[model samples]
Target: MVLDSLGKSLRGVLQKIARGSTVDEALLAEVVRDIQRALLQADVNVQLSLDLTKRVRTRATTEKPPAGASLRDFLIRIIYEEIRGILGKERPFDLKPKRILLAGLFGQGKTTTAGKLARYFQKKGVRVGLVAADVHRPAAVDQLEQLALKVGCEFYSNRAERRAEVIVQEALAHFPAHLAVIVDTAGRSGIDPDLIAELKRVRAVLQPDETLLVLDAAMGQTAGRSAQAFHEAVGLTGVILTKMDGSAKGGGALSAVSASGAPILFLGTGEHIDEFERFEPTRFVSRLLGMGDIQTLLERFDELSDKESAEKAAQNLMSGRFTLRDMRSQLASLGEMGPMSKLMSLFPGIGAAKVDQKTLDATQQRLRRFRSIMDSMTGEELDNPHVIKADRVHRIARGSGQKPQEVRGLLKHYESTKKAAHGLVSNRRLRRQLEKQFGNAEAPAD
Candidate 1:
């Protein structure tokens, strides 16, 4: 949901186009104007925004729609291409075991990114190690060590050594074989002379496979200048934009960095280490245009729940045997996928529907509360909710620190869900459709 305001504006433009009786020059002009306004308000460079909209206009007017495509589809395709162009090509990271050096300005999340990057590769089945070479910051080494422990990665550091180069050499010497070493370098408030000198020293010794510059998404237009400075200093292989989930200036930072010639390799979506993801320009633009990102969604689901578990859950629901325990597991899986608003944004038409943020937030809160209530329930209560009478409801509410009405509401939801699930389980036509969709044998009717 980064650059949410801009997404809303772009969605509005598309809606207006879809509603138009005809596609004409005037309509194209209005669409272009709306796009320009949205990009500008998102803090995009004026020239970049103008150039993008101009290209969109030319293509929409001159090029004919594909044989089977409508004018609206063609116009939408043009806009998608233009936006993708500004975002630049996707630079995929090689998860192979290799040394990576992280560089950035102070408070740009370089230390945290080092941890996240390690976790990303670890999840990909790579043996990763963290080397803390940030000797200047008092807590840098400790923070990296804590993160390494939290992610279950090897940690290497030296509190006694004042020289970063010496510390890095020692850490590398002690680094475990077959594990990828991620070296964390010191950063300053700005690109100061001392910081540059120290980074150069570390780079010379480490000779890392990838030198990644971490940039803050909220830096806006200044991101380009910062990127250029780091590129000139250490010859960056790629950039990682951090704090993307909460930044309104994410679009500007992304465009500016892409324009500077260093492709964005990953986006730090949230504070959690698992929130990191490799940047994909095409899929990203699709999601921004209100088209679903099925690839990413499937990847997230795969990460949260294995194939066997998913199949088991589906079978249980289809058999009308779902319990409070099953519902809690499902909720946990969804929570791992990140915010509901973000997940919904990946659904086609949902983004354009302009769902209120408050509503999404409330739904997420309610689901969490329901999980909490379930946690307080006894095994027998989870197995058979019908056994819970008025007295049980009061006890459960007190145990969960929730109102009695809230407890009743959860039971109501469970009943409704159970009824719908039974209906689906019994419908022959629906079972056939599901079988076709999943390419699996149909289960016997419950």
Candidate 2:
């Protein structure tokens, strides 16, 4: 789900109608054409895609399937086998009390990813600490502090306007026992000597076990230049592509991995501290081929979804007690789980068509605005959006650092949620439908 449209054009043509030994040439040609289109649209290297297509085509015609195997099965099998071979094997990060330096463009979400990577390792029972080494004009230190809290990891920052290298030095001085340290650095608007020097300064002393180049998936080919610049300066061990939740063509993600000659280690899917997914070559290739990936869904749920909280949310909805406050809480939970699209895809048949591309993009924009407005509110106001009268809206808009219109939009979102909450309560069929769609194990049988 990182690049929602990456595999959108992929059409796996199932031409073999019945379970028959005989295969036709025209159908084979059509299926191969469809495969090529899908791979290209997925931002897969064109030559790689062409070569793969050739293999699949040649094998489809020349190699005969065993007696009982359907042509569909034969084709799927061949495609999977070839890709698995191409993807090769993966070597995960295995560092102990090791340092990992995160480098990327200013708005590429490097600081946030540093925190997420810490959380990922923390899950494995590793001690993790972060240094707010991003000493630039941006509020990078503050961002790291906030995300560090969300991950329950320690944060170190003098915020003394110290240079990036100095901050890393201080972090090393106070480095916790047996901990993984993530040193985040400020980024520039473009690839330049100054930016590279700042990162090189940090890289020179730390000599980290892994240096990840953070990039935005939406950056398109621009990501290529940034990756190349960083690699030339400090040599990236891997890459982390952020904002995978957006409608990025996935082209930039592909470009960074292929061109940078660095393995993709992690992906940032949302705004939350815990919103990340590790790279899995097999699953990714499967997705590129329009093959469903249920494993990713389950793994994400394990990391993000709290069963107890979900049960409580369900009971609240059934009892007609869900409010704007509940909506906010639920959204926070969803953010913790990676991309919104990925979460929606888990809802039975919703995966196939829950939200179209346009609506999904708009919803993400609206949600960001909504969250900003909510942040501006006091605890009481969040519980009672109705209390946000005109004057109060203006005050909150200023306090939250958002526009007055955004406050109103937040109210509208609350109104919509309130209506849906009550619907789940009064309508028995609606309750059943909701249960069937998102019910927890303990949900009442309405």
Q: Evaluated with lDDT, which candidate comes out highest?
A: 1
Worst 10 residues of 1 by lDDT: 437-446
Cα RMSD to native, each candidate?
A: 15.0, 20.4
Off by over 4 Å in 2: 4-11, 14-22, 45-48, 62-71, 81-89, 287-446
What TM-score does candidate 2 get on C-alpha atoms? 0.59
TM-score of every candidate: 0.66, 0.59
Residue 350, model 1: Cα distance from true site in angstroms: 10
State candidate 1's TM-score.
0.66
Off by over 4 Å in 1: 293-446
